[model samples]
Target: MKFGPIPTLQAKGSILAHSIVCSGRRLRKGVMLEDAHIEQLSASGITEVTVAQLQENDVHEDQAAAELAKALVPDVRAAGLECTAAFTGRVNLVATGPGIVDLQADRLIALNSIDPMISFATVPNYQQMRKGGLVGTVKIISYAVDAEKLRSACALGSAAIKILPPQLKTASLVVSQNANRNDEKGISAIKTRLDALGITLEKVIATEHEIDPMAKALSSLKSELLLILTSSATSDSNDTAPAAVRAAGGQVERFGIPVDPGNLLFLGRIQSRPVIGFPGCVRSPALNGADWVLSQIACGVSLNENSFAQMAIGGLLKEIPTRPQPRRPKK
Candidate 1:
């Protein structure tokens, strides 16, 4: 792209590089200079203006960005994602359904490293998104770019963004309680969380807070996922919840996460079904480590020690100021 000042009379057919005010009328940037525009500028005493003229091998800014964005999210469309039309060399990707947003962070970084003119940004990986949520966007800095560079950037974004639909739609809650089974508040909180994610709470099993009894309850329940809410947080692999999972013929995948407010969370698998030992943080509606784990599980992503460990980067959920204030004055 060649950009420089050109005389108004000779600026016809060139793209305006900058917005200008002439004769009380605005000629916006990216506007193609025509005979009438040149006449208007000449009449307004503006002899010269800056504009960008594309070379034979260079692509237009909008075309380059649109093509790259299209290449980046081709599969996203079929997965219930919508791509907006390129505007000012930008294209935004929006979600069409509620689901988990998965992003290829490494590939995105590499793509951005290719050239400063081409850039892409997206929401954090594994974010729970509602319909119409902005997931990703492509921005082209210059008015135009080399087609070869555009191609190189697009190649790095293959399968870069994905909206994984919720798969684990049903779950059973097994509460380990030594006292009465009438914990309406606890059950209601769990139910509300599951319902918001479109997951059904199929059964609620209340049993003694012991390995044997909890294991028996787990083995008897049938659901896509099992949630074990122990009366106390499990502190070891041999703790009641983890041991119960083992006794129920399940493997404890991970004991704890690095996330605060959810460091007590435990993960296991029983006969290909996922099991989670809920942390005390889950009793509230605020987002925490358990929400992150549950979102990944609902998206059919396998959970293990590495998965739990990887969450430390953005796991400071307790620091978020979304919690309810007990001492606040009522409106």
Candidate 2:
């Protein structure tokens, strides 16, 4: 059965509000958007527009693009911005006068030289890249954009996508208890905690599960972080414990936080993706493992092995002042 052509798909998920630009006019600073305005934009063809109070309390670039996209509706061009969609909150729109066949090599060269982590994803210009021809709709992520890079990228046979270091979304939560029922309960508790923090957890998987199958699932879903929470009592020696992580790829880290009730926590990641292990203490109302780890990851801090180790400097030790010993007995 043939389904009708669907419109272009952009990245969908929670994104940070970096900067907001609108019609090159910053929406009046304190002016709250009216629902009527939102409805009007939506009906006019602006799809999936959502507004919320932001940490910055002021719009920046990303927010500006999003708002412009929302206002322009059916006619993105009418919005006064140069691009149809902006990904990664960092983008440079090169106006090719509406029929430009390709972005130039200089564009990619410029963006690449500035940051090695810059990457591209095949977008509307797939055929162009294949034929060494130019196309449109290249998405790029870079620390900064160069005018030359913008020109060169568009000059390519087709528009190309430049993405940053791929972000891992799959988090592995390892429950140590042998009882399936207990493991399920622990997983439920952890999920609840994560949800409160606005982190969407994918699944609670068993450790013994095969890597190939597990990886296949994660790949299909495009998950980047892995979180492991343990309830099993393994020897501190690390000999009896199952592999800390099953994935042959990704990052890993262990946490022994200074926070009360959660000092026993451990977190590991396979690559840049997170693999966190939360001890039973997370269930307690007291601040626990999930609290600290969740905050760091939310702020875009990659919890690698070294960062985890650094966490130990002030984390595990307790402050106990020495009390003066009782006076010695008289001879």
Candidate 3:
């Protein structure tokens, strides 16, 4: 692209490089200087203005950004997302329905690295968003980019972000028999959190705190998802909850995550069904590691050891001030 001063009379069909105020009206940058605009600038006594003229191989900014954004998003709409028309070298990914934004951070990083002129940004991975939320955006840095660079960036960014509809629709809660009064509060809190995600707590199984009974309960339970709310947090893969999962012929994917307030969370699967061993922090509805794990499960995102490990980058859930405050002593 060639950018330099061009006489207003000769600037027709070129993109304005900067906004100019003329006769009480503003001519914004990126506006293609039409004959009318050229006449208006001449009438306003503007002799010359800086503009960008595209070379034969250069792609227009808006078209390039729109194509890259299209390549980045998956072909499947997934239920809650809409892609806006590219404008000003930007295409915004908006949420059409309320749900979690599931972004592939690693792929996004790769996409951005492919070209300096192309970039993308999104709400944090696994963020709960309302309808019409800005989930992701694609931006091209210059008035125009080389066609080859745009194509390379698009190849790198294909299917890098997804808006997943909440999928943890039905669940069963298994609590220990020695569950205290706090258990009621915890159950209520879990219900409220799940309800927000459109998950229903269809059945409750209260059993002895022993591993054998827990295992039996898990083996016998029939639900799309199983949640174990233990009186105590599991300390290891061999802990009671995880042990029960193993005894019930389930595979324990991971024992703990790097996220605080959710460090004790356990993830396991039994015959294709997900089982989450909740940490004590789950008793309260504050955002925590458990919420993160649950949100991923609900969104149908695959979970494994590496998935929990990758969360360390943004795992500081307790640092948010709006997080539920610890109970204070009665005056």
Candidate 4:
């Protein structure tokens, strides 16, 4: 695109590169200078104005942004995302419902590498997303961009962003507590977490903080997802929660994720039902490793061995104020 100062008489049909006040009216930038606009500016004693004129081979910013958005989300319904109408040089993608943000990172990187004038930004890969949440955005920096580069970006980023909506609609939580302990915080916290993913907590059964009782409770669960929150923190793969899953005829896949504040979580499955051992950090609303696992499972997005390896990469979460100890010892 050609952008520079030009005589008011020669500015007609070009995009205004900057906002200016003319004839006591505020003319916004990106507006196409017309004959009346030029005449008004000339009458107001303005001799020059900067504007951007599109070249034959250039694509208009709004058009380019709209096209890129379409390419990124081919089927809005299936992708579980909706594209807002392109405005100026921006188009936003939002979730149609609660789910997980499944972004294609490699494709996004390639798209951004094509040129500096176009950018696609998103919430990270596998992010927990809620209904009407902002998933991603496409922005064209300049008033116009090279058509060839825009096409390349569109092709490389095709179908690159989507939301995996929740698959499991209901869950049953089994809490283990002593006879005198009637703490409802764990149950409330678990319900809040499940509600965020649009899942219903069908039952909250409290049992003795014992392997046999908890195992029996877990084995009798009929919800799509099963959960166990022990009064004591799970310290190892062979701890109470994981051992209870095994005792319930379930297969324990993993124990003790690497995320701080959530390092004690365990994952397993009973035939078809998935079980999650909530860590002590779940009493707070802050993001933790358990939220990641729950969101992935709720969306039916399975990973090999229900992997905790990926969690370690960005698992150092903000410490909850309720934590009794710090990550490091005092000097």
Top-lDDT structure, candidate number: 4
Cα lDDT tens digits, model 3, 132-244, are: 88988889888999898888788777877777887667998888767453488778888887887778899888888889999988998888899999886688899888999
Pairs of residues clashing in candidate 3? none
Q: Say which candidate scores most in TM-score.
A: 4
- Order the candidates by TM-score, highest first: 4, 1, 3, 2
CA lDDT of 233 in candidate 4?
86
Candidate 4 or 2, higher lDDT: 4
Better candidate number, 2 or 3, judged by lDDT: 3
Poorly placed runs, candidate 3 (over 4 Å): 74-80, 95-107, 124-131, 164-168, 177-180, 206-220, 236-240, 243-253, 320-331
Give candidate 4 regions above 4 Å deviation. Answer: 305-307, 329-331
**Residue 199, model 2: Cα distance from true site in angstroms:** 2.0
For candidate 1, which ten residues in a row score worst on lDDT? 319-328
Ranking by lDDT: 4, 1, 3, 2
lDDT (0 to 1) per candidate: 0.85, 0.40, 0.84, 0.89
Model 4, 184-282: lDDT tens per residue?
A: 987888899999999999998888888888899988889999988888888888887888899999988877778887888888999899999888888
Model 1 lDDT at residue 314: 80
